[model samples]
Target: MLSTMRSGVRRHSALLLFILGAVLLTPLSQAQQLQTKFGCNMTRDEDGEKVIYGDTGEFKLDGERIEALRWESALYRPTHGFECSIDTSDDPQAEVEQDGDKSNWRITLKDPVAARHQRGYDFYNHGMNCSIRLQRDGDKLHVIPSCPALCGSRGNFTELSVDLKTGECSYK
Candidate 1:
């Protein structure tokens, strides 16, 4: 009877330790997935004109739900230049929806004219329909933007590829 009781106690202690370890490690694992940052900068000379463009952003999550995000893009050309930016730090119109490893961000501008003017693209009419999609695959983050009104003639935000490991970005 004594040996049997000792074995039972040992088993219970082992189970308790396992449970405590899992409880302690769970949050650390979740915290690792709670934040992500990506950006890229590239410049090239085409037709004797230097073109500079890139995207940079950071997003924070709370148990798979995006809590905040700030993304910006810029393009410079000889004839035209534009810059676009979105922030959810304090804007109620900014919404982010998560589906698996993909997220869709949409924002309704309260002052479309001011937004356009701030980005230095006042020529393009502000339609107040700004949308962006993001996908994460391993160490790569793909950014796809459909906000034509935010980006003028010389700016393109589609097919932006970011290397999360290296903080580099390029347009494919």
Candidate 2:
């Protein structure tokens, strides 16, 4: 009779432990919620290529994550990329004077992106690696991209800045 009680108690304890473990390990909606910080995501489909300016991707109401274009002919690279800066500034000369080392503005993209440049000449022939960063200043959003050796020259890294409020992106 005592052995029977001991066996039942052991079975109940095991069942309680299993229940406690299951409760602790459950996701409980944390896994299903959308990302709200820093704003980064990849495109789910190849639908943005249908248009010229590109389509919208994962973005927040504050525009932390704006629309990114991914359009590359499968024959070219079998991947998509951003072509230059989206909204070029009406005049880039003024911003050029303020350009400097933006090594700290590098951002790791969540999506595989491809970009093209129509410079006076494609000195490098191949696209250069770029580091894009975003900064909020008062009522403006600044998009900065740093490109090293764009023209294969020394001390001539191209740095660009885009004012989100005015939709003006210039070589800053």
Candidate 3:
């Protein structure tokens, strides 16, 4: 009876150790496997579908389209558009290419850009026309973009997710 009790305690201790080790390593493994370069906030619409605000890209204020250089006197901008429930790809290599009326935007992460945006060790040029602020929260991101004063006026300063092609804002 004494031996049996001793064996049972040993087994329980082994199980407890296993659980503790797993809990400790889980976060490390998950962090290493994270591949998403989280961009812009995606919200749920009326139907609860995930979506990023697709802005007009034209950068307007008070219903008037401002020039590229006059984008600093503005206040209130909306440029986030990614929703967890509906956002598909967390591709680390998204980029934007101007194609016809809309843009062909792909959010890609090359080593050079990854270091600056992720680690903050390097610097990437903030195009005078627009500035994208990428805020990292653990494995997630709060992507925000602003129309700088270089665009002409204090332009649209919203951090809304804009459809690169249509520049349409998500109405949700």
Candidate 4:
């Protein structure tokens, strides 16, 4: 009889532990509802004309997790190292300035990923000096490196646009 009680107690304890572990390890998505995935569409503007700038991606941010959605295009510049974020607060304004130029827009995200330059940078005076731009309209946040200047005046100044709500990117 004692053996039977011991076995039952052991089984109950194991079941309790298993239930606790399962509850603790369950994914947050399974426990809670997830809103629509944050995304963006990127477009670009060049040479006084609007063009479908190819090869871009969108980023989704949940709390602190950021995921990049890449598009297949041979012309997209890889954004690897840079500092950008979306700030959505009482004041909805996002801007980044480079090469003595300033871009002001009205969309705020927490922290957006950095896109690499299509063409790298010129090493001058031991300081990184590059031309980039900021294109802003309504809920769109676009980042364009002042390219024509970087391309020895042979390339077009590209523009990057992002939808603030969905984090979509489109190169113009």
Instruction: Pick the lDDT winner.
Output: 1
Q: Write the per-residue lDDT of candidate 4 for residues 31-104, one digit (tens) a residue.
A: 22112223333445546554443434333323223232222222333432122222222122233222222224
Total clashing pairs in model 2: 5
**What shift in Å separates residue 138 of candidate 3 from its native position after superposition?**
4.0
TM-score of 2: 0.26
Looking at candidate 1, what is the lDDT of residue 29? 46
Estimate, for each residue in 1-172, the C-alpha lDDT of model 1 and write its tens digit.
Answer: 9999999999999999999999986755453343667777778897899998767777665543456777778887877776777666324254455555454444445565555566667665545455565655667666777665566543445458777788777786
Superposition TM-score, candidate 1 onto the true structure: 0.57
lDDT-based ranking: 1, 4, 3, 2
- The TM-score values for the models, in the order shown, are 0.57, 0.26, 0.24, 0.30
Q: Compute the lDDT for candidate 4.
A: 0.37
Writing each residue's lDDT as its tens digit, candidate 3 over 1-172 gives 9999999999999999999999986754333221222123334453454433322222211111111211112222244321111011111233333323222222222333333333232233433333443332332333354423122222334454334343333332
What stretches of model 2 exceed 4 Å from their correct place? 1-66, 69-106, 109-128, 148-171
| True-structure Cα RMSD, model 3 | 17.3
Indicate the residue-level lDDT of 116 in model 2: 26
